[model samples]
Target: MSISPEKVFEVAALGLGGNIGDPPAAMAEALRQLDRRDDCRVAAVSKLYSTPPWGKTDQADFFNCCALVETSLEPEALLDVCLSIERGMKRVRLERWGPRTIDIDVLTYGTREQKTEKLEVPHPRMTERGFVMKPLADIAPDLPVKGRKVRDWLEEADIGGIKVAGDQDWWRAR
Candidate 1:
């Protein structure tokens, strides 16, 4: 069966992370797949960084980054795409903050406020994750979060070392 295209919302932000396998490579592949989706288009990508794992630090440090996508898919549908990418990368949900091949979370879906058993808009903990905020600021510094700019949030946020993974096409198709 084929899927029908819907009117895409102008902008969306997705947070990507992983600590297993080649994290940078997995992140890049996720972006490539996302960009290939008919209902979504990757508009921008933030610099990659390595950070101490949140929730649990016993595992390997996480490679993290964020991407801006233009899409017509609703929040849940968008999330499905992310989950598919994670599964394709062999993500194992053994424990919270446990090592995985890939992890993708929707940070924001346009400016809409939504809450359901399955998903939440403006990600419940976006402000708390340095991995999410740092890259978010890199790409959309002036973006408003809860009526305040992302830069302001970053300044007040308890964020630590975040190194930019150089090389723009590091994950591009050959």
Candidate 2:
């Protein structure tokens, strides 16, 4: 038996975060840019979440969300698109985990595991972030992470002050 090319699957999991000017608007613009790609389709999006800065907590809190997309592009190509969107949004990567006008990360790209100098699939640290897990679980409740259910991981995850920001649809329909 052999697997068919048509059956070869590809899906995209994107994590969006921003803390600089009009974070919500920046996210909406990112979604619109993703929607413009012919090889990808925005399938579902998680609710917006507000969480304290993870690493350098000396900055503004971040507005975060996750999006599940269906894309035929390989992980690296998809990553390129994400970076392009960031640049177009005037994103300034001044510091590690620092406040930004917009930030987009490829959290997962199908089940394919990949590592390159510039990108990593199934984002190495995604499972450890509550902001990522919370929204991911909401949209993909049964999603498996390191062999555990997303919901389960969320339960024990230290999400302290993370809160649902506003109407979920408000961001998606943008």
Candidate 3:
């Protein structure tokens, strides 16, 4: 769907990562693509982070980060955009928490709360993952997730091996 100039924008948070191939390059391209869209604009991006794998834990560490986007699309539509970005970057769902070229997750959409068969907003597991929270804190430390600030959650999240891999302008590189 195309957005007109008069469309109202909503601020949304996104979690992005990957463990295979040139994940950082793929992620930067994803952001560039999103920023080029008429319906969306990347407002803020967090620093890149090298973090231990979560969930499956057996694969290689992931390069992770978060982005704040101002978009005119609704929750489901935003999710569709994210999925399209992933697919375009050769993302494949071979296994749960397995390796991939790129992964983009919609963490929040304004103050909206949604749970549908295809997507969920304020991502159901955002608070439980340090990979998501740590980078998220860099861009939106005071942003609330489930009534608690992201920084507050960061304090409790297990960020053991997570480390900054790049500065906030990391996404600007080709």
Candidate 4:
């Protein structure tokens, strides 16, 4: 079967979450910004979830979700786009696992395995974070990560305080 060039975009998954400000709104805006990019398109977005803060338990709960994007940009460039959007949304990095206005992580990129100072595909810590795994499973249950499907990792993740906050179209709201 001849593959069409138009069907060659790489599919990437992004994990988005935030605990400060209007997190849901910030996340929605971030998704809109990505979809506005000429080289990227938001393919699918999972339901919004309210999850307990990990690592730093001093902060408020976080709103989290995952999105599948079809893009022509390379993995690094896509990560750059995500970072740019976070900056645009005023994300402040005070400390590792600290609260922020918005945070976006490139979870996977077209089945690639990459490690760099600035980015990592199939995010190294994804399997251990229920906040990321649960939402990711909603959109791409069978997606492979570290030789395991997202659903599989989710089965082993600690999802104690996670609860659905909105439907699949949650990102459509302001």
When summed lDDT is taken over every stretch of 10 residues in candidate 2, the lowest stretch is 3-12
Off by over 4 Å in 4: 1-7
Clashing pairs in 1: 8-72
**Error at 64, model 1, angstroms:** 0.4
Candidate 4 at 33: error in angstroms?
0.6
Q: Write the per-residue lDDT of candidate 1 for residues 33-60, one digit (tens) a residue.
A: 9888888899988878888888897888
Worst 10 residues of 3 by lDDT: 2-11
Q: What TM-score, over all chains together, does every model reach?
A: 0.91, 0.91, 0.96, 0.95
Candidate no. 1 TM-score = 0.91
Candidate 3 — what's its lDDT?
0.94
Show the lowest summed lDDT stretch of 10 residues, model 4.
Answer: 2-11
Which pairs clash in the backbone of model 3? none
Instruction: For candidate 4, write residues 138-171 as lDDT tens digits.
Output: 9999999999898999999999999999999988
- Compared with the true structure, all predictions reach lDDT values of 0.84, 0.85, 0.94, 0.94
Q: Give lDDT: candidate 1, residue 163.
A: 71
lDDT of 2 by residue, 1-174 (tens): 997776344778899999999898889888877878787788888889999999889998999998887888888888889889999989988899899999889987766778899898778888889989998887887876667777998887779899998665757655
